[model samples]
Target: MREKNHVRNVNNRNEMEAVGDYYLNNKTLGKGEMKMEAAMKMRIADIGDEIVSNKGIKGKVEMVKENSVIIEILENLSDREYVNNRTVVSHKNYVII
Candidate 1:
């Protein structure tokens, strides 16, 4: 029984390490350096500016949170429905137009 438990623990640790390596080195998974088109930072004053996602979702900034912005999705690009249709978009995942 002890040997079985030890083997299970080893397998779990190996699986966790493999997952970590995948996240840190997989280019397809958005690892490593990223491209930034603009160097300007998003401020509270730019809350009303139009923003777009890579997936073509257009929305206006409703609120700004720590490291993310709350957008009231104005278009019908997404199928999911929420109360007033809001989504928390990451600052890196969107562009202010």
Candidate 2:
């Protein structure tokens, strides 16, 4: 699976809390009727939690945002200089482990 993380702008999400009520955006809701989507409860992912990305990369949750979590990539698979091992992964792109 493609990793839909936004590591391109890691510094931009420095203000999100490390834990709290995490909400889902339209992407996370996926394809569904509007009414049912609106009535769904939010998912929770706290700091220190382990999550695996859609691409199968494991990470430790460092911060929690409105619709994503800042994670320290557990596996160093990228060879690029900017990977940094930290990225913002959408709630829908990863599963808590």
Candidate 3:
């Protein structure tokens, strides 16, 4: 039983280290620097459409593309909004819901 517990702890530690490595290798910026474009996903909260605001939509980036991202939005209703690629920084901190 003690050996089994020790092995489980080691496995957990290894999993955590792997997660840390992925974040360190993939993270784009140092403190206060603008995020790398490759590291960002399209956010529905950043869209200029009123519908996004009304539905309180929040999104997670599923995939990034050359000019856009595929995102999964969490909201009560569904709709599409077009956002300018350059305007994301202005809305990065907005509360989606």
Candidate 4:
């Protein structure tokens, strides 16, 4: 009885823990544990800069704001969920291509 319970617990724990897979791709994540891209902070994004959003929406930067940038949708690699031609994406949500 006790042996069977231990086996189940072990299996469950193993399934829940996948910590070392690229750090970002993990099931066992704690607070403040994150890795940012170098281009996200170092690169200066500007108007006409091509970027791909986190959701795989490809677009050009139409305007730049303090926190986010206005993008004109050029190509959507994901799906047709985006019904608008222009979108506002945060700096953290996209990378300049």
Candidate 5:
């Protein structure tokens, strides 16, 4: 019984470590899609929040030439702007938050 408990503990620790490693790698590699997914999953304002790309971390529209909004992203430190109302090309590094 003691041996079985030890094995279970090890397995639990391994699973925890795997989850930690996955988050660490993704955080370092700067996956834009992952960041966008996380942002979209957040319940900041409310459900059915209008997703717009303009000049803010979260905007109501994508493109506003006047007074461009800038949001500082923790992950994916790429120099890119989210233009409102534009379809993003796949495999490109742009934050659609």
Candidate 6:
């Protein structure tokens, strides 16, 4: 059964590779057909809200930018070098605590 499944998987992979090659040779991706996948909506951290950095340090949201935020470190877990005032942090860089 395992051998049969493996054979089927190989056949499917070969078929996919052939389709990929054909598409590579013929550059015709239809308009609006290749739309971006759903992305996580970024919720900007509000002022005074506590946040934790990816490095495990706690901070507060000082200001919101166009695509980032200004975080002021309020708590530190380790002696790691922290980002200064001007360091812009994006939504993915921190989590609201």
Best by TM-score: 4
lDDT of 5 by residue, 7-28 (tens): 1122221121111112222232
The clash count of every prediction, one per candidate, is: 0, 0, 0, 0, 5, 0
Best by lDDT: 4
lDDT of each: 0.46, 0.53, 0.28, 0.55, 0.27, 0.45
Ranked by TM-score, the better of candidates 2 and 6 is 2
Between candidates 2 and 5, the one scoring higher on lDDT is 2
lDDT of 3 at 13: 16
Ranking by TM-score: 4, 2, 1, 6, 3, 5
Q: Which of the predicted structures, 4 or 6, would earn the higher lDDT when compared with the native?
A: 4
Error of 1 at 30 (Å): 14
Write candidate 4's Cα lDDT for 13-68 as tens digits: 21211111111223322322322442324354699988766555678899999989
Better of 4 and 5 by lDDT: 4
Better of 3 and 5 by TM-score: 3
How do the predictions measure up, each by TM-score?
0.48, 0.50, 0.23, 0.56, 0.17, 0.48
User: What TM-score number comes out for model 2?
Assistant: 0.50
TM-score winner, 1 or 2: 2
